[model samples]
Target chain A: MRKNYFHPKNLDGVYSVYQIEGLNQDRLIKNLKNGGLTLYNVKKIANHKMSLEISVKQDKNFFAIVEKMCYTNLELKPKIDKKRKKLLKKGVIATKSECGYNIKLTRVHGKAYPLYYLFTHVGVLIGAIIFCLGAYHVDDYIFSFEFTGSGNVVENRVVEYLNSVGVEKGKRFSEFDLNVLADGILAENPLLSYAGCLKRGNKMVIELVLAKNGTDILDESIKSLSSDVDGVVKELKVYRGTPLVGVGDKVSAGDLLVDGVISHKDVQIETNVLAKVVVLAEFNYTFISQFDDRETHAELLAIESLNLPVEYSKITKQPDKDGYLYTVTLYYNRVFVAG
Target chain B: MSFLESVKEIIGLEQFPAPVFRATIIGDVAGFFEGVVDVQTWSDEQIVIRLKKGGFIINGKNLYLKKYCAGDLVVCGKITSTQRI
Candidate 1:
């Protein structure tokens, strides 16, 4: 669509700048014009050197004519357009070097942001927003649950207990209290020495530690007998010590039920004694739980290591007029420590 | 005219026109039909273009041959005036 302004009908119009050097350059111009090519702005700076503008579309014919005329040196440079020529006249470029361009900005006004980039790549911003929203929403609920120390615990029982306590799938993890879950699972399971509840991302991990059960050793090392659970006494027998709790008496765990210091004819003899006490009917608990490490599960482990008459305990929760009612059931009655 | 003839005339595809040398002079641009024989004098202030028979001395400031084809010459500069020789 671009036609030469001068020879609009004859010349190809696409101009290119070239430096031509040769002897008898005046003859070269005549020869080039005769060769069906248009030359513009031919400047004869010297007898042998002339800079000129020629249509690039006639490049083949121009080169052939130059070669035929024996013009040895010819170099092509970038054509300076009208706009760039105007800028050159204004001396906008204060310095020039080959390494790089150090642009000097001048007279820029108005406050603006790089909103062009955001507008150009809207899909990336939308995708990032969606990812963040998905992450935030997914974090509110636990997706999957994994069990450790599964060999000693029943998986179905754990799942059932979780569902019963409203800790099942699609439930918000933040809604259920972790400590309540840990203690609830710990108190119910006799074999699990520790129960830990931990939430990682969308997955719930429960770690249970199995207590090591051994034969009954009536070692005289145990100084006195202590109650292992908070429950009413079902039966009691004292062979070598006086019983401080009778039947139907509610005693808390860690309470000394039989004392090592007893009055033997007012002699104040201090010696270990043997006693047997049974609390609530024995029961077994199976559930999923997680224990982080030794330090955190110490309290749960301490309860199990006591090795008292109550080998395990279970807690059942119910809604009553006075908020929630928690019932503690002590079971797994073993022979009281033969202290 | 036919569509084909119009297209050729617009693209300069038709054969060259008659050789009667004519210069269409404008304020700063002067175009000539039918080429000059040779450039007798060329400078920033003056240009002497030789024709087949006679020539014209165009005296101006920054006068140069804007383009010169087989028989077409375009002279562009700040023209004070022109004279025939």
Candidate 2:
């Protein structure tokens, strides 16, 4: 006869075991069915000696009810073998006979899913959301300009100059040749000594250092002098030699504004100090103007994965009349200066 | 072994006095009685044995068998019986 026994290798869900005595065959079968135990094979080896094999699905608390029911049986002297006792000592294993039908019941009850799969799914979703947000927040393309020296220049004139040379605010710094732009702006105004253009993060900065022109002085040899240009007298300074013109007198260019010689008694002393004065002048001029009134837009061009370049609208000027016109151009760039 | 040789061996040429030399304690010098090349005699009742680091002074009241002189070896015990090297 071929002897057949339960194979531990094949029983993937067996965790622990429990031995029970004084249970009638009929009562044991009834209890097994009521307890939701799915018996795989039941063989009666001898008088009251039976070998029962079963299986169950994996769950966290599948054998809890069976454990409680077995404890309540007062007449049952459960003698567990060494293997079953060792499994019971571990405290988490569900025996084959107790775990069988309960495994199916738990499937119906909706449980038993791998935890790693759930965590991985959540991680992927979070990663995708973060990636999208980063893409939206990134400012890839940037261009700007800046100005230096005295900021008290006419705004419209600078803007006009910038527009004429295609160096407007929204335009990319790389589009304009910085050296050529500097030369053009300096050519328009001889008063500016050095003009520079550069690019910073999202901005273009332009710097202009003004020429140091000497102020006009007056000689005290003149009898009287008055201002030729209309202006508010800001300051009046006196030389120690002689008075060419008294207080409250306005003088123009090429006029003897002050006297350096002083006549006292029989000696005439010549002083070296030159008289200086400052006046705030406002020159008023008018000319006809025309504007496109069209909204300007920018276009971005990616140079590489990290670098981006941009372009802007073109500007054209139309002649209106033969008169004095003030044109101001402001070109912004990002720049650094060593002090 | 012969009796004479054993007797000579028992009574070694080097004699040691009782109350073997232990250690040294420095204090005010009691007046000097005599001075020699390898030894010095003090008027006080103790004798001092000089070492490289310090000196060991022995009291006359603890002196047992051997007589201590200004230039004597002043042996306290056999060299092997001494606790120090």
Candidate 3:
């Protein structure tokens, strides 16, 4: 219980208002304030109205007396507003506007507080859910393959080699070794003159240029045209004529491995022809050897055990040499020996 | 002055600064005017410029400017061009 004193011009004396659960305005005012109180201003609060600026004699226990008088012998007849009562009965006005204020305060505070909190909380939750879903479903995060060079020569071979080396679509780019794989692909397919591989995001892209065809092979028959180093003919291809030698044949470095000779002296006229031959002359080599003796020992031996009524014998021997050795004597508990 | 020196001066006066001239600078003098010279000594594609007082050969894409003689005034599309032919 609380008491407040307020003044009004219409009132003859100061009005002391009792702020309890119910309304008993006349008695509350009369009991709270004696005849000596005088009036000044009035204002309305949540459940009731009261006046302020009332004059009272200053005393040590004045506030205590007022508080006691407001609470003592209180009778509450709820002065419910008829409009509010009608709205409540009809259940139509869920929220009520304060008489002078622009904002509407809900009649049920518990329901309104959660409803307000839910609006913002649910909005944030829904936004977070949408963000997560977008992050999960978006395909913008991807691997990209970038290629370079003229379209005709090296592009197809590079792409084919990249695919063969397990860098196909949908594979992560980090799994590939760009330089090693590029070098490997170039070495494997001689047609690719040069190749460079790069990884971007989850994609592997290769750039390559093809070696031009019709590059001149040295005419060794004309001894003037020869390489400084002697090279065994690992392979030989005759574009204009037949091959002179099969695989594993030897020929000198300046030897005419490919001959452009024609035998037109015969009755049958021969055309200008070329022949290819393979040669294997000499090569530098090195050899290496490593062996372990422990493995060989384990493979040669097996364990054997024999048991009698009161004793046992254990032995380790090779598996294949059992029948050759004869048992000449046997000892029982070191008492007697027999064959 | 000698006859060659007079002829050189006259030729320099007559032509557009005698488009091509050879100058040799060794030791400390090499550092003073390094990148200031823009001369093409090889084909027009290959231009010799100074970098850190050392010669740098820049290979450009176009080669048409190579045909001009040593002292000829070679101009291309309003760009003043000179070279040591």
Best by TM-score: 1
lDDT of 1 by residue, A1-339 (tens): 996544322333345556654455567777888888778777755555566776555655776765454433232232223543354456542223321212111111112212322333578668878999998988989889988884234444566578778898788888998878978876666556777888988888887777576233557765678877666687677778667888888777787778777787878876777766766544333222233222323334434554444555555555555444444444654335464
Ten-residue stretch with the least lDDT total in model 2 chain A? A330-339
Task: Give the root-mean-square deviation of each candidate in angstroms.
Answer: 23.8, 31.2, 40.6
Better of 1 and 2 by TM-score: 1
DockQ of 3: 0.00
lDDT of 2 by residue, A172-240 (tens): 555668788877776666556666766556665567766666132334354333344443344556545
lDDT of 3 by residue, A213-266 (tens): 524353433311121224345545455432444444544455444334433556
Which ten residues in a row are the worst by lDDT in model 3 chain A? Answer: A330-339
Please list the residue runs of candidate 3 whose C-alpha ends up more than 4 Å from where it truly belongs after superposition.
Answer: A1-98, A104-146, A189-194, A199-204, A210-339, B1-85
Calculate the i-RMS of every candidate, to one decimal place.
1.6, 52.8, 53.9
Looking at candidate 1 chain A, the ten consecutive residues that score lowest on lDDT are A101-110
TM-score of each: 0.32, 0.22, 0.22
**lDDT tens readout by residue for model 2, B1-85:** 7774576569873354322222322232121212111222221244444433344444433222121233223232212112111
Chain A TM-score, candidate 2?
A: 0.26
lDDT agreement with native, every candidate: 0.62, 0.39, 0.37
Best by lDDT: 1
